[model samples]
Target: MEEKNMFCFQCEQTAGCTGCTGNTGVCGKKADTAQLQDELTGALIGLARAVDDTSAVSKKTWQTIIEGLFTTITNVSFDNAAIEDMIQKVRAEKDSLVGDCNKCQSPCGRTDEYDMQQLWNADEDIRSLKSLILFGIRGMAAYAYHAYVLNFEDPEVNQFFCEALFRIGYAESMDELLQTVLKVGEINLKCMALLDKANTQTYGTPEPTDVTLTVEKGPFIVVTGHDLKDLQLLLEQTNGKGINIYTHGEMLPAHAYPLLKKFPHLKGNFGTAWQNQQKEFDHIPAPILYTTNCLMPPKSSYIDRVFTTEVVAFPGTVHIDEQKDFTPVIEKALELGGYKEDQTFTGINGGTQVTTGFGHSAILSHADTVIEAVKSGAIRHFFLVAGCDGAKPGRNYYTEFVKQTPSDSIVLTLACGKFRFNDLNLGEIGGLPRLMDMGQCNDAYGAIQVAIALADAFGCSVNELPLSFVLSWYEQKAVCILLTLLHLGIKNIRLGPSLPAFLSPNILNFLVENYGIAPITTPEEDIKVLLKQ
Candidate 1:
């Protein structure tokens, strides 16, 4: 690997509001690791394009491609060795495809890997469009990885990962890149659907459940991020060990799944969102197992207690390998011995508990009553003001926006962003809480299902419904979800904590002109505008 500073603008935390061209990422990724990630991405693209046909890509090749893309995602992996190993696996996969390239009479030049520098220096428009595709598939791979672990796989979603990576390296013009960009959204919709099916089928559909903010006195483990499989395994390993597991961040909604919730020691949720972990986990007598994204650089107070598994890694943190044994996480909880008494914590708004599990099944079960209430004018309009929450000061916009919604309007939410207002007692309409927690970030699928179902009930398209999406994005998953919404032709979305740095003026204008996507203004102003629309 080169010993030079790396350039990466793939995420929200890029340096100086542009790219990270330094020795370390704002998220704490070291310079050498960034180079390896870029190298891995380049090799994967070459492997993807080199195969003469789709069938020529073996199962191992596909696995290598998915694992490679997912690992490069921001805050997902920090181990240079692990990244180096994955890069080698990808290269080995490529070598198998290019076997006897020199001996063959028909030599294909497509086997060559395109340098990532080319895309980085390309015209801003082409760069933005291709970034959307590459980043989208990276996010989608997390969802696909979860489903595959549970034995659910969709061939189309799998195929697109290869195709999009291939295009990212080779697509030359704006027109060619734009096609793959939109298709990222389209395929991700399928990928998220596949994950939804896998989760629901394996764990049973989620139901409404109230999660407490209090931590029980004893040995306890706090699980964070988007992986239910990791959480489930931990629950099993810690079951009879006198330890309790509390969900945090994106893992909060795991409490709703029938199979996961069945664990007696699963207990309740701990912290508000990923952004609060540095404060919440400090001096806490428990281990935080990060299974996926939104891993902030750990603090010294709790650094030793934080263990990462799967794609989530921070250098010097104990990494649980593919064996998935969470013994370290369990042992750390025991060593800390927890609090002397049951600790009562409150949400940011001081509520004692938050409610989740308002997934598609639960919401649609009450669909007729919801439609009746809408017809009777009991509910004025619906606002879907949810996505990834961040540590930025302005992110309080979501809390204020949710608070300012008309009492008659129902607020639907998913992902960590809901933590902003999830603990608030927003009351209810027709027996359903006005602010409904629609599971995790992956449960964006459930939110989509509910939107489509509502549109069907009202004899209109989803865009024609009274619902409006006010989304806050911080990572690649949010990017993929945004693309999925655009692919479905949903319009008038409001995005913020500032628009992505990746979007050039022209690319952003293309979005604004074509889809009516705009950044959030003041909550007071945007709510008034959206309500009128």
Candidate 2:
């Protein structure tokens, strides 16, 4: 038997392994735990395969696939029992598809469970390419799942999700894998657009919302993650009960939307990035709610008060079903009684309030001002300092990166990672705040729109503009966003805390040669290189 250090390192906090190959992750995933996750993924692939044709996809199939994939995300579901239940659902869906296939006697040969190990341990180049495909699809699935919960579903996005999963299960060869990688980007673009539409249409375009870090006294719930619908439901259930709701992590954007912000009891933000949850939620005098991913296992001090809705699940935490009844969570918040007096918390940068909702619509509406500033040399460059945050000490590079950017430049940031510096009062340039918060991770769509609009206004390709991407990636969402940038032919992107463990040298070389993607160095050196460009 091969002796191994706990083989798990797919996250910012990997154990000794570059990509956790052993019986447990450094984060505490047991070997059997890892195997169940793989099995759940395989079952999802089987369900995807069963939907080889469009006719085979039902609402049930899409829900199962999305939930199954979400369950496999790091820290979301660690329970073997939950994973087994999901596997059974996937099998049942596959069975239904087989029944239909048998009646028609049409063997598509498309439905089959993929051995995830094939992608994990393939030839380096093929593994990198396939990893991009699989990870991108997983990230895109999260967005689609959010839209699904709001009763808004996109047929093209849903069908392509299944198609992508099917290919991941069956495709072979580096060339084939490379195509699948780019296709993930293409489909993710549509999926993001669909989500943007769903979010805006449902909640109205996010505006410039200045959310305070001050937690109002009385019972409150701190809701975290990317699900606006879940937050809205909580707000609704807690309304008039004197229980205040606070947004946390990606849910911070919920404070900016008109539909959601209308809740009188929806107070302000709580805590910073997801990684800080263990400390931030310690002995918190409120019931905390997790609506999506980036959930660390709760410490015992606060575990009893944590509530999960949607796809987020941690064993022993209460799970809210589709009805969205948040009574139990509300009851917990009231029981905790919160702080005796209003307590003020600050962002990592010590700013009392962080501003968000400057999405594409908000930014583009001021296009004339931005264009004039550029023409007048008031704005010399645009820097998109965005991506996921990790536990690496080097992540301080971002804070330093934003700090060192030339005063004449504008910084556009998105994702929870931006919480590192978004609260800093970088002030403004030419009537625009130096750093613009462009909503959540999915709001990378907003950043892309702003770029395209700027390109159009200047009558040049987006690449021709003086814009540079300094991204920090920690998960599959970042994977899909990077692929989108590549799909757009955008170049000269600086990525860190580290290049993905899945990116082989050959594939990395391909990206370097074609897209000029490079690992981030020191902020001082990166600023010099970006300014030189």
Candidate 3:
């Protein structure tokens, strides 16, 4: 096969639904940017080998691996310079551990950096399994990094990062790689739980709260992505400065945390999901600070107001560093001067306000009420219509799916996909809202907890309960979450807008035959099929 400028199919919106092999990908990643990311991944694989060889791996080495994986996630880093620097850091970490290997006359190839192209060009099934392990860890790294930012550390989670990367580079057999793939899911479950604990313990468990779509008059900033620690820091710096903060994308759930919402100026939400940001932020009079992934290339009009922090870097955007001082963002908001009058924004469904914060703790607190509702025949079924949102055409399936859910059933949603139908008032079943907004994508762990409690209450397994999972995915974070679900033996999951391009025919069939995972059909048809079960 002839070499291409670049190759990527790790996202749902990959070009032609096969691979993005051109000067740029469908996500606006340039060929040079993609090349640099692959180099960085290669360097990280080397670092993992170094860690495996040496027992003296420091805290910084683990942090480097986590940050490196997070940086390669889709829509996170597009700046070649930032990625180049990250590659250097990864190599430096490896050199620190294995410096003496350079002097050895008979150096083994074990510590050599594995070229990513080899895996990309491997057999189709091997490629599929390896991609699952690589992409799943990329997503899990984001969760681990968030937990680390809150001063939380899990040794098992950290060690698994190196172990998984080593497997990605060295494990060659189908069975060996497949075991590692499932292990990614197993480790990510604990990573997500660590993040959940870090978040709840740091900011208090989320409670149901109503966040408006209105942006009040005067200066304000829009914070997007998944990092609550960055939001907390920005909120602290902006306090008493007369500047309000509005949540966007996955940051919308931050309003449910007790410590964050206590600030009067941590006002309502601003826009819809991340995919809509280019349109929603066009010429808007505020600076947007991106704390993690889901950052689209900015339009020329709004480029100046884009400020990135942590690993979310686009060329030419201002970035906040480790000091966590948000003065630059605060100053940009002040300079924009905001609107002369208040601006009322609604979600895609045109609702003036939306309610969130039904995390696992909040939901489980009323387990008796929920079980009674289920046993008394008041609630017919539960639908978990969640995952990331993208610009792909068929994504409207999620909106239509929720719209068609029977009034007797309840809809539980998370991540940005909820933006599709979260604003619609599904009314209530018993005292619970028919549509419950579980926190962010990481909150899927909470959703699992709720499902288990419900299953235990009815003296049945989760598969036997009247529950369905209809997920729409965009990037690797969704990949990890889906793997987590599959690892738990959950069956009959309907995935859309399209199945992942990375899954080979054999692998896809395996999931279908064993796990009952299938591409979503029309909302009307799927609803009927799920209800009859």
TM-score of each: 0.97, 0.95, 0.99
Candidate 3 backbone clash number? 0
Model 1 Cα lDDT, one tens digit per residue, 103-181: 6787766777778889888999988998888889998998998888888888888788878987888777788887788
Q: Backbone clashes per model, in order?
A: 0, 6, 0
TM-score of 3: 0.99
lDDT of 3 by residue, 1-533 (tens): 23359989999999998999999999999988998899899889999988998999999998999999999999999999999999999988998999889668998866788899998999999899999999999999999999999999899999998898898898888889888888888988999999999999999999999999999999999999999999999999999999999999999999999999889999999899999999999999999999999999999999999999998899999989988888889899999999899998888989989999999999999998888988889999999999999998999889999999999999999999999999999889888999999989999999999999999989999999999999999999999999999899999999999999999999899899989998999999999999977
Model 1 scores a C-alpha lDDT of 0.87
Clashing pairs in 3: none
Error of 1 at 41 (Å): 0.7
Residue 66 error, candidate 2, Å:
1.7
lDDT of 2: 0.83
What is the Cα-based lDDT of residue 291 in candidate 1?
Answer: 90
Q: Candidate 1's error at 360, in angstroms?
A: 1.0
lDDT of 2 by residue, 166-280 (tens): 7677777777778778877887888888889999999998999899999988888998889888877777777788888888888888888999988988888999998889999
Q: Return whichever of 1 and 3 wins on TM-score.
A: 3
